[model samples]
Target: MADQGVRTDRLGLLLEQFDQAREMAQVRLTGLGDEEYLWEPVADCWSLRRRGEAVTPRAYGPGEWVLDKGAPDIPASEYAEVARQAAGGMPVSKIAEDWSVSVERVGEVLAFTGTPEPDRTPVTTIAWRLAHLHSCFAGQWEWTFGERRRDPRLLVDFTPRAGLALEAFWATIDRWREDVASVTDEQLDTVGFSQYPYGSDPDDPFIAVVAGSGLEFIHHMAEIALLRDLWRARFPGRG
Candidate 1:
Protein backbone atom coordinates (compact mmCIF):
# COMPACT_ATOMS: atom_id res chain seq x y z
CA MET A 1 0.00 0.00 0.00
CA ALA A 2 2.83 2.39 0.87
CA ASP A 3 4.56 1.62 -2.44
CA GLN A 4 1.32 2.29 -4.30
CA GLY A 5 0.96 5.67 -2.63
CA VAL A 6 4.52 6.64 -3.52
CA ARG A 7 4.00 5.62 -7.15
CA THR A 8 0.74 7.57 -7.37
CA ASP A 9 2.46 10.65 -5.97
CA ARG A 10 5.29 10.34 -8.47
CA LEU A 11 2.86 10.01 -11.36
CA GLY A 12 0.90 13.02 -10.20
CA LEU A 13 4.09 15.08 -9.98
CA LEU A 14 5.10 14.03 -13.49
CA LEU A 15 1.74 14.92 -14.93
CA GLU A 16 1.79 18.27 -13.15
CA GLN A 17 5.14 19.06 -14.67
CA PHE A 18 3.78 18.38 -18.14
CA ASP A 19 0.64 20.40 -17.46
CA GLN A 20 2.66 23.42 -16.36
CA ALA A 21 4.97 23.18 -19.33
CA ARG A 22 2.10 22.82 -21.78
CA GLU A 23 0.28 25.78 -20.30
CA MET A 24 3.33 28.00 -20.57
CA ALA A 25 3.96 26.90 -24.15
CA GLN A 26 0.36 27.58 -25.06
CA VAL A 27 0.71 31.10 -23.76
CA ARG A 28 3.86 31.61 -25.82
CA LEU A 29 2.30 30.17 -28.97
CA THR A 30 -0.68 32.49 -29.01
CA GLY A 31 -1.04 34.77 -32.03
CA LEU A 32 1.95 33.21 -33.80
CA GLY A 33 1.70 33.81 -37.51
CA ASP A 34 3.05 31.89 -40.50
CA GLU A 35 5.79 34.35 -41.28
CA GLU A 36 7.05 34.31 -37.71
CA TYR A 37 6.84 30.54 -37.54
CA LEU A 38 9.06 30.02 -40.58
CA TRP A 39 11.37 32.96 -40.09
CA GLU A 40 15.03 32.00 -40.40
CA PRO A 41 17.31 34.26 -38.38
CA VAL A 42 20.51 32.98 -40.03
CA ALA A 43 21.72 31.14 -43.08
CA ASP A 44 21.92 27.32 -43.14
CA CYS A 45 19.50 26.88 -40.28
CA TRP A 46 17.76 23.54 -40.05
CA SER A 47 14.05 23.86 -40.78
CA LEU A 48 10.96 22.31 -42.19
CA ARG A 49 11.09 22.49 -45.98
CA ARG A 50 8.96 21.82 -48.98
CA ARG A 51 9.86 18.69 -50.86
CA GLY A 52 12.82 19.09 -53.26
CA GLU A 53 13.87 22.34 -51.53
CA ALA A 54 15.69 20.63 -48.68
CA VAL A 55 19.48 20.88 -48.62
CA THR A 56 19.92 17.89 -46.40
CA PRO A 57 20.84 14.48 -47.82
CA ARG A 58 17.33 13.24 -47.03
CA ALA A 59 14.06 14.50 -45.63
CA TYR A 60 11.40 12.62 -43.67
CA GLY A 61 7.67 13.11 -43.08
CA PRO A 62 4.66 12.81 -45.28
CA GLY A 63 3.09 15.03 -47.93
CA GLU A 64 4.77 18.06 -49.51
CA TRP A 65 6.69 18.95 -46.35
CA VAL A 66 9.59 17.33 -44.48
CA LEU A 67 12.26 17.99 -41.87
CA ASP A 68 15.71 18.94 -43.19
CA LYS A 69 18.00 16.50 -41.48
CA GLY A 70 20.92 14.61 -43.00
CA ALA A 71 20.88 10.88 -43.50
CA PRO A 72 24.06 10.33 -45.46
CA ASP A 73 23.44 6.63 -45.89
CA ILE A 74 20.22 7.40 -47.72
CA PRO A 75 20.78 8.64 -51.24
CA ALA A 76 19.33 12.08 -51.87
CA SER A 77 18.43 13.95 -55.05
CA GLU A 78 21.47 13.66 -57.30
CA TYR A 79 22.95 10.93 -55.17
CA ALA A 80 19.90 8.70 -55.61
CA GLU A 81 19.91 9.34 -59.34
CA VAL A 82 23.58 8.48 -59.51
CA ALA A 83 23.05 5.24 -57.69
CA ARG A 84 20.11 4.31 -59.94
CA GLN A 85 22.08 5.07 -63.08
CA ALA A 86 25.09 3.13 -61.86
CA ALA A 87 22.87 0.18 -61.04
CA GLY A 88 21.48 0.31 -64.57
CA GLY A 89 25.07 -0.02 -65.92
CA MET A 90 25.42 3.67 -66.80
CA PRO A 91 28.94 5.07 -66.66
CA VAL A 92 29.87 7.41 -63.80
CA SER A 93 30.79 10.15 -66.27
CA LYS A 94 27.37 9.93 -67.93
CA ILE A 95 25.60 9.93 -64.59
CA ALA A 96 27.66 12.95 -63.53
CA GLU A 97 26.46 14.98 -66.52
CA ASP A 98 22.85 13.98 -65.86
CA TRP A 99 23.20 15.00 -62.19
CA SER A 100 25.03 18.26 -63.03
CA VAL A 101 27.99 17.22 -60.93
CA SER A 102 31.52 16.09 -61.54
CA VAL A 103 32.11 12.32 -61.68
CA GLU A 104 34.22 12.60 -58.53
CA ARG A 105 31.41 14.43 -56.70
CA VAL A 106 28.95 11.72 -57.72
CA GLY A 107 31.35 9.11 -56.40
CA GLU A 108 31.68 10.98 -53.14
CA VAL A 109 27.92 11.19 -52.80
CA LEU A 110 27.58 7.49 -53.40
CA ALA A 111 30.25 6.73 -50.82
CA PHE A 112 29.05 9.18 -48.16
CA THR A 113 28.11 7.51 -44.89
CA GLY A 114 28.35 10.16 -42.20
CA THR A 115 25.37 12.00 -40.66
CA PRO A 116 25.65 15.54 -39.36
CA GLU A 117 27.50 15.76 -36.06
CA PRO A 118 25.91 17.18 -32.91
CA ASP A 119 28.58 19.90 -32.66
CA ARG A 120 27.47 21.12 -36.07
CA THR A 121 23.73 21.28 -35.28
CA PRO A 122 22.22 24.37 -36.79
CA VAL A 123 19.68 26.85 -35.48
CA THR A 124 16.06 25.89 -36.15
CA THR A 125 12.96 27.97 -36.74
CA ILE A 126 9.73 27.72 -34.78
CA ALA A 127 8.21 25.45 -37.40
CA TRP A 128 10.99 22.90 -37.03
CA ARG A 129 11.00 23.11 -33.24
CA LEU A 130 7.25 22.66 -32.99
CA ALA A 131 7.29 19.81 -35.49
CA HIS A 132 9.99 18.10 -33.43
CA LEU A 133 7.99 18.44 -30.27
CA HIS A 134 4.94 17.09 -32.01
CA SER A 135 6.88 14.14 -33.33
CA CYS A 136 8.29 13.33 -29.91
CA PHE A 137 4.91 13.37 -28.25
CA ALA A 138 3.11 11.57 -31.03
CA GLY A 139 5.78 8.94 -31.37
CA GLN A 140 5.99 8.31 -27.65
CA TRP A 141 2.25 7.99 -27.40
CA GLU A 142 2.01 5.67 -30.37
CA TRP A 143 4.72 3.38 -29.08
CA THR A 144 3.44 3.45 -25.53
CA PHE A 145 -0.30 3.20 -26.02
CA GLY A 146 -0.99 2.58 -29.69
CA GLU A 147 0.40 -0.10 -32.03
CA ARG A 148 4.01 0.31 -30.82
CA ARG A 149 5.37 -0.77 -34.22
CA ARG A 150 5.14 2.26 -36.46
CA ASP A 151 8.28 4.12 -37.44
CA PRO A 152 8.64 7.44 -35.66
CA ARG A 153 9.56 9.17 -38.92
CA LEU A 154 6.12 8.35 -40.31
CA LEU A 155 4.32 9.23 -37.10
CA VAL A 156 4.16 12.99 -37.78
CA ASP A 157 2.78 15.06 -40.61
CA PHE A 158 5.00 18.06 -41.17
CA THR A 159 3.71 21.18 -42.82
CA PRO A 160 5.22 24.36 -44.21
CA ARG A 161 2.10 26.21 -43.13
CA ALA A 162 2.08 27.38 -39.52
CA GLY A 163 -1.65 27.25 -38.76
CA LEU A 164 -2.00 23.61 -39.75
CA ALA A 165 1.16 22.73 -37.88
CA LEU A 166 -0.03 24.32 -34.68
CA GLU A 167 -3.38 22.63 -34.92
CA ALA A 168 -1.83 19.22 -35.44
CA PHE A 169 0.67 19.72 -32.66
CA TRP A 170 -1.98 20.53 -30.08
CA ALA A 171 -4.12 17.64 -31.23
CA THR A 172 -1.22 15.27 -30.74
CA ILE A 173 -0.63 16.65 -27.26
CA ASP A 174 -4.25 16.06 -26.36
CA ARG A 175 -4.10 12.47 -27.56
CA TRP A 176 -0.89 11.85 -25.61
CA ARG A 177 -2.26 13.43 -22.47
CA GLU A 178 -5.47 11.41 -22.67
CA ASP A 179 -3.55 8.15 -22.71
CA VAL A 180 -0.96 9.19 -20.15
CA ALA A 181 -3.68 10.25 -17.72
CA SER A 182 -4.88 6.66 -17.53
CA VAL A 183 -1.54 5.08 -16.58
CA THR A 184 -1.76 3.19 -13.27
CA ASP A 185 0.70 3.33 -10.38
CA GLU A 186 1.94 -0.16 -11.22
CA GLN A 187 2.51 0.86 -14.81
CA LEU A 188 4.34 3.99 -13.68
CA ASP A 189 6.90 1.92 -11.83
CA THR A 190 7.17 -0.70 -14.58
CA VAL A 191 10.35 -0.56 -16.61
CA GLY A 192 9.66 -0.74 -20.35
CA PHE A 193 6.32 0.89 -19.79
CA SER A 194 6.80 3.46 -22.49
CA GLN A 195 8.76 1.37 -25.04
CA TYR A 196 9.50 4.44 -27.09
CA PRO A 197 12.24 3.18 -29.38
CA TYR A 198 13.98 6.47 -30.06
CA GLY A 199 15.09 6.92 -26.44
CA SER A 200 16.02 4.99 -23.33
CA ASP A 201 12.42 4.64 -22.21
CA PRO A 202 12.46 0.87 -22.50
CA ASP A 203 15.15 0.50 -19.87
CA ASP A 204 13.92 3.13 -17.45
CA PRO A 205 10.99 3.19 -15.09
CA PHE A 206 7.84 4.72 -16.57
CA ILE A 207 7.91 7.49 -13.98
CA ALA A 208 11.42 8.49 -15.08
CA VAL A 209 10.38 8.49 -18.71
CA VAL A 210 7.44 10.71 -17.81
CA ALA A 211 9.73 13.11 -15.96
CA GLY A 212 12.24 13.16 -18.80
CA SER A 213 9.47 13.81 -21.32
CA GLY A 214 8.36 16.76 -19.22
CA LEU A 215 11.94 18.05 -19.36
CA GLU A 216 11.97 17.71 -23.13
CA PHE A 217 8.72 19.64 -23.35
CA ILE A 218 9.87 22.42 -21.01
CA HIS A 219 13.22 22.96 -22.71
CA HIS A 220 11.94 22.81 -26.27
CA MET A 221 9.01 25.05 -25.45
CA ALA A 222 11.49 27.50 -23.90
CA GLU A 223 13.55 27.39 -27.08
CA ILE A 224 10.45 28.04 -29.17
CA ALA A 225 9.52 30.99 -26.96
CA LEU A 226 13.01 32.42 -27.29
CA LEU A 227 12.90 32.03 -31.05
CA ARG A 228 9.61 33.93 -31.12
CA ASP A 229 11.14 36.76 -29.14
CA LEU A 230 14.17 36.90 -31.41
CA TRP A 231 11.94 36.96 -34.46
CA ARG A 232 9.90 39.82 -33.03
CA ALA A 233 13.07 41.75 -32.24
CA ARG A 234 14.58 41.15 -35.66
CA PHE A 235 11.57 42.52 -37.48
CA PRO A 236 9.85 45.08 -35.34
CA GLY A 237 6.09 45.43 -35.87
CA ARG A 238 6.13 42.37 -38.13
CA GLY A 239 4.30 39.07 -37.61
Candidate 2:
Protein backbone atom coordinates (compact mmCIF):
# COMPACT_ATOMS: atom_id res chain seq x y z
CA MET A 1 0.00 0.00 0.00
CA ALA A 2 1.17 3.54 -0.69
CA ASP A 3 0.28 4.17 2.94
CA GLN A 4 3.06 1.94 4.17
CA GLY A 5 5.62 3.83 6.22
CA VAL A 6 4.60 7.07 4.52
CA ARG A 7 2.99 9.91 6.45
CA THR A 8 -0.80 9.83 6.26
CA ASP A 9 -1.46 13.42 5.21
CA ARG A 10 0.55 13.34 2.00
CA LEU A 11 -0.82 10.04 0.77
CA GLY A 12 -3.14 11.98 -1.46
CA LEU A 13 -0.44 13.56 -3.57
CA LEU A 14 -1.47 11.79 -6.72
CA LEU A 15 -4.85 13.43 -6.33
CA GLU A 16 -3.09 16.75 -6.36
CA GLN A 17 -1.30 15.81 -9.56
CA PHE A 18 -4.57 15.00 -11.29
CA ASP A 19 -5.88 18.41 -10.39
CA GLN A 20 -2.71 20.14 -11.53
CA ALA A 21 -2.68 18.45 -14.92
CA ARG A 22 -6.30 19.36 -15.63
CA GLU A 23 -5.96 22.96 -14.51
CA MET A 24 -2.76 23.45 -16.50
CA ALA A 25 -4.38 22.08 -19.65
CA GLN A 26 -7.47 24.24 -19.15
CA VAL A 27 -5.48 27.42 -18.72
CA ARG A 28 -3.43 26.77 -21.85
CA LEU A 29 -6.43 26.01 -24.04
CA THR A 30 -8.40 29.09 -23.03
CA GLY A 31 -7.36 31.64 -25.65
CA LEU A 32 -7.62 29.68 -28.89
CA GLY A 33 -10.68 29.98 -31.12
CA ASP A 34 -11.61 27.45 -33.83
CA GLU A 35 -9.29 28.99 -36.41
CA GLU A 36 -6.16 28.33 -34.42
CA TYR A 37 -7.42 24.99 -33.22
CA LEU A 38 -7.86 23.71 -36.79
CA TRP A 39 -5.08 25.58 -38.56
CA GLU A 40 -2.51 23.46 -40.37
CA PRO A 41 0.78 25.14 -41.24
CA VAL A 42 1.42 23.09 -44.34
CA ALA A 43 -0.26 21.32 -47.22
CA ASP A 44 -0.77 17.60 -46.49
CA CYS A 45 -0.39 18.41 -42.79
CA TRP A 46 -1.87 15.77 -40.48
CA SER A 47 -3.97 18.08 -38.34
CA LEU A 48 -7.52 17.55 -37.06
CA ARG A 49 -9.47 17.55 -40.30
CA ARG A 50 -13.21 17.08 -40.14
CA ARG A 51 -14.15 13.47 -39.65
CA GLY A 52 -15.00 11.31 -42.70
CA GLU A 53 -12.41 13.22 -44.70
CA ALA A 54 -10.77 10.70 -46.95
CA VAL A 55 -7.87 8.84 -45.39
CA THR A 56 -6.50 8.14 -48.82
CA PRO A 57 -3.66 10.33 -47.66
CA ARG A 58 -3.24 8.30 -44.44
CA ALA A 59 -0.34 10.67 -43.85
CA TYR A 60 -1.73 12.21 -40.67
CA GLY A 61 -1.63 10.59 -37.28
CA PRO A 62 -4.79 8.59 -36.50
CA GLY A 63 -5.27 12.21 -35.95
CA GLU A 64 -0.23 14.43 -36.69
CA TRP A 65 2.21 17.36 -37.22
CA VAL A 66 4.12 14.72 -39.21
CA LEU A 67 3.22 11.84 -41.57
CA ASP A 68 5.14 9.05 -39.88
CA LYS A 69 3.96 6.57 -37.24
CA GLY A 70 6.17 8.45 -34.75
CA ALA A 71 7.69 11.59 -36.17
CA PRO A 72 9.73 13.76 -33.80
CA ASP A 73 9.70 10.55 -31.83
CA ILE A 74 9.37 11.94 -28.33
CA PRO A 75 12.91 12.47 -27.15
CA ALA A 76 13.58 10.62 -23.90
CA SER A 77 13.34 12.71 -20.76
CA GLU A 78 16.77 12.87 -19.14
CA TYR A 79 15.36 14.20 -15.90
CA ALA A 80 12.89 11.39 -15.48
CA GLU A 81 15.50 8.82 -16.39
CA VAL A 82 17.94 10.22 -13.87
CA ALA A 83 15.25 10.39 -11.22
CA ARG A 84 14.30 6.78 -11.89
CA GLN A 85 17.95 5.72 -11.73
CA ALA A 86 18.34 7.26 -8.30
CA ALA A 87 18.44 4.54 -5.63
CA GLY A 88 14.85 3.80 -4.61
CA GLY A 89 13.31 6.04 -7.27
CA MET A 90 11.67 9.41 -6.67
CA PRO A 91 9.28 9.89 -3.79
CA VAL A 92 5.57 10.14 -4.59
CA SER A 93 5.34 13.82 -3.78
CA LYS A 94 8.34 14.68 -5.94
CA ILE A 95 6.86 12.71 -8.82
CA ALA A 96 3.70 14.73 -8.47
CA GLU A 97 5.67 17.94 -8.64
CA ASP A 98 7.56 16.68 -11.64
CA TRP A 99 4.32 16.06 -13.47
CA SER A 100 3.14 19.55 -12.64
CA VAL A 101 6.27 20.92 -14.31
CA SER A 102 5.73 18.63 -17.24
CA VAL A 103 2.15 19.84 -17.66
CA GLU A 104 3.26 23.46 -17.54
CA ARG A 105 5.93 22.87 -20.15
CA VAL A 106 3.29 21.39 -22.40
CA GLY A 107 1.49 24.72 -22.32
CA GLU A 108 4.64 26.66 -22.92
CA VAL A 109 5.45 24.73 -26.07
CA LEU A 110 1.89 25.03 -27.31
CA ALA A 111 2.55 28.75 -27.44
CA PHE A 112 5.96 28.28 -29.04
CA THR A 113 6.20 25.52 -31.77
CA GLY A 114 6.96 27.43 -34.99
CA THR A 115 7.76 24.89 -37.71
CA PRO A 116 5.97 22.56 -40.15
CA GLU A 117 6.39 18.95 -41.32
CA PRO A 118 4.19 18.34 -44.31
CA ASP A 119 6.13 15.16 -45.10
CA ARG A 120 5.69 13.50 -41.71
CA THR A 121 2.71 11.98 -39.76
CA PRO A 122 1.56 15.59 -40.17
CA VAL A 123 0.83 17.57 -37.04
CA THR A 124 -1.70 17.20 -34.26
CA THR A 125 -4.09 20.13 -33.94
CA ILE A 126 -5.34 21.40 -30.59
CA ALA A 127 -8.57 19.58 -31.28
CA TRP A 128 -6.77 16.27 -31.70
CA ARG A 129 -4.85 16.65 -28.48
CA LEU A 130 -7.96 17.56 -26.50
CA ALA A 131 -9.87 14.68 -27.97
CA HIS A 132 -7.01 12.36 -27.17
CA LEU A 133 -7.09 13.54 -23.56
CA HIS A 134 -10.83 13.09 -23.35
CA SER A 135 -10.89 9.63 -24.88
CA CYS A 136 -7.96 8.32 -22.88
CA PHE A 137 -9.16 9.61 -19.52
CA ALA A 138 -12.76 8.56 -20.12
CA GLY A 139 -11.70 5.05 -21.03
CA GLN A 140 -9.41 4.71 -18.03
CA TRP A 141 -12.11 6.01 -15.71
CA GLU A 142 -14.63 3.56 -17.14
CA TRP A 143 -12.29 0.63 -16.81
CA THR A 144 -11.08 1.42 -13.31
CA PHE A 145 -14.29 2.67 -11.73
CA GLY A 146 -17.26 2.49 -14.07
CA GLU A 147 -19.28 -0.38 -15.47
CA ARG A 148 -18.30 -2.29 -18.62
CA ARG A 149 -14.82 -1.54 -19.89
CA ARG A 150 -14.81 -0.66 -23.57
CA ASP A 151 -12.26 0.33 -26.20
CA PRO A 152 -11.91 4.10 -26.25
CA ARG A 153 -11.50 4.18 -30.02
CA LEU A 154 -14.81 2.40 -30.42
CA LEU A 155 -16.60 4.42 -27.77
CA VAL A 156 -15.37 8.01 -28.02
CA ASP A 157 -16.49 10.41 -30.72
CA PHE A 158 -13.24 12.15 -31.66
CA THR A 159 -15.12 13.99 -34.36
CA PRO A 160 -16.72 16.54 -32.04
CA ARG A 161 -16.09 20.20 -32.85
CA ALA A 162 -13.23 21.81 -30.95
CA GLY A 163 -15.40 23.52 -28.31
CA LEU A 164 -17.33 20.37 -27.45
CA ALA A 165 -14.12 18.39 -27.35
CA LEU A 166 -12.56 20.79 -24.89
CA GLU A 167 -15.65 20.68 -22.67
CA ALA A 168 -15.67 16.89 -22.62
CA PHE A 169 -11.95 16.79 -21.96
CA TRP A 170 -12.18 18.94 -18.85
CA ALA A 171 -15.20 17.09 -17.55
CA THR A 172 -13.52 13.74 -18.02
CA ILE A 173 -10.43 14.89 -16.18
CA ASP A 174 -12.65 16.08 -13.35
CA ARG A 175 -14.19 12.63 -13.07
CA TRP A 176 -10.79 10.99 -12.97
CA ARG A 177 -9.59 13.47 -10.38
CA GLU A 178 -12.54 12.67 -8.13
CA ASP A 179 -11.80 8.99 -8.37
CA VAL A 180 -8.13 9.54 -7.57
CA ALA A 181 -8.95 11.65 -4.53
CA SER A 182 -11.19 8.95 -3.13
CA VAL A 183 -8.58 6.17 -3.25
CA THR A 184 -7.83 4.32 -0.02
CA ASP A 185 -4.59 2.83 1.24
CA GLU A 186 -5.80 -0.65 0.46
CA GLN A 187 -6.53 0.40 -3.08
CA LEU A 188 -3.07 1.81 -3.41
CA ASP A 189 -1.43 -1.41 -2.31
CA THR A 190 -3.78 -3.71 -4.11
CA VAL A 191 -2.54 -5.42 -7.26
CA GLY A 192 -4.67 -4.40 -10.19
CA PHE A 193 -6.42 -1.59 -8.36
CA SER A 194 -7.04 0.26 -11.60
CA GLN A 195 -7.87 -2.74 -13.77
CA TYR A 196 -6.88 -0.63 -16.76
CA PRO A 197 -6.23 -3.22 -19.50
CA TYR A 198 -3.59 -1.61 -21.67
CA GLY A 199 -0.74 -1.60 -19.21
CA SER A 200 0.48 -3.56 -16.18
CA ASP A 201 -2.39 -2.46 -13.96
CA PRO A 202 -3.70 -5.99 -13.65
CA ASP A 203 -0.58 -6.86 -11.68
CA ASP A 204 1.22 -3.65 -10.72
CA PRO A 205 0.67 -2.06 -7.32
CA PHE A 206 -1.67 0.87 -7.17
CA ILE A 207 1.17 3.12 -6.07
CA ALA A 208 3.05 2.06 -9.16
CA VAL A 209 -0.01 2.84 -11.22
CA VAL A 210 -0.10 6.32 -9.76
CA ALA A 211 3.49 6.84 -10.78
CA GLY A 212 2.98 5.43 -14.27
CA SER A 213 0.05 7.73 -14.86
CA GLY A 214 2.20 10.76 -14.17
CA LEU A 215 4.70 9.77 -16.84
CA GLU A 216 2.03 8.91 -19.37
CA PHE A 217 0.24 12.21 -18.96
CA ILE A 218 3.43 14.22 -19.07
CA HIS A 219 4.83 12.51 -22.15
CA HIS A 220 1.70 12.69 -24.26
CA MET A 221 0.99 16.29 -23.37
CA ALA A 222 4.56 17.19 -24.19
CA GLU A 223 4.26 15.55 -27.59
CA ILE A 224 1.14 17.56 -28.33
CA ALA A 225 3.01 20.72 -27.38
CA LEU A 226 5.94 20.03 -29.68
CA LEU A 227 3.47 19.49 -32.47
CA ARG A 228 2.06 22.89 -31.66
CA ASP A 229 5.52 24.33 -32.14
CA LEU A 230 5.78 22.60 -35.46
CA TRP A 231 2.39 23.94 -36.54
CA ARG A 232 3.28 27.49 -35.60
CA ALA A 233 6.66 27.54 -37.31
CA ARG A 234 5.06 26.20 -40.44
CA PHE A 235 2.43 28.93 -40.50
CA PRO A 236 4.55 32.02 -39.61
CA GLY A 237 3.38 34.79 -37.16
CA ARG A 238 0.00 33.11 -36.80
CA GLY A 239 1.80 31.23 -34.04
Candidate 2 on 1-239: residue-level lDDT in tens? 55574333544666566557756756666655566667655565444544456333432334412221232221233333424423345443333343433544433333434442333244555665565556667767877888746764444555435576667666777777777767887887888777766444665677777767666776667665665666566765773
The models' CA-based lDDT, in order, is 0.80, 0.56
Estimate the TM-score of every prediction: 0.75, 0.60
The positional error of residue 111 in candidate 2, measured at the CA in angstroms, is 41
Q: What tens digits encode model 1's per-residue C-alpha lDDT throughout 100-166? A: 4577877887786655233446798898889888888988998899999998878887977788888
Query: Each candidate: how many clashes?
Result: 0, 22
Q: On a 0 to 1 TM-score scale, where does candidate 2 land against the true structure?
A: 0.60
Using lDDT as the measure, the top candidate is 1
Q: How accurate is candidate 2 locally (lDDT)?
A: 0.56
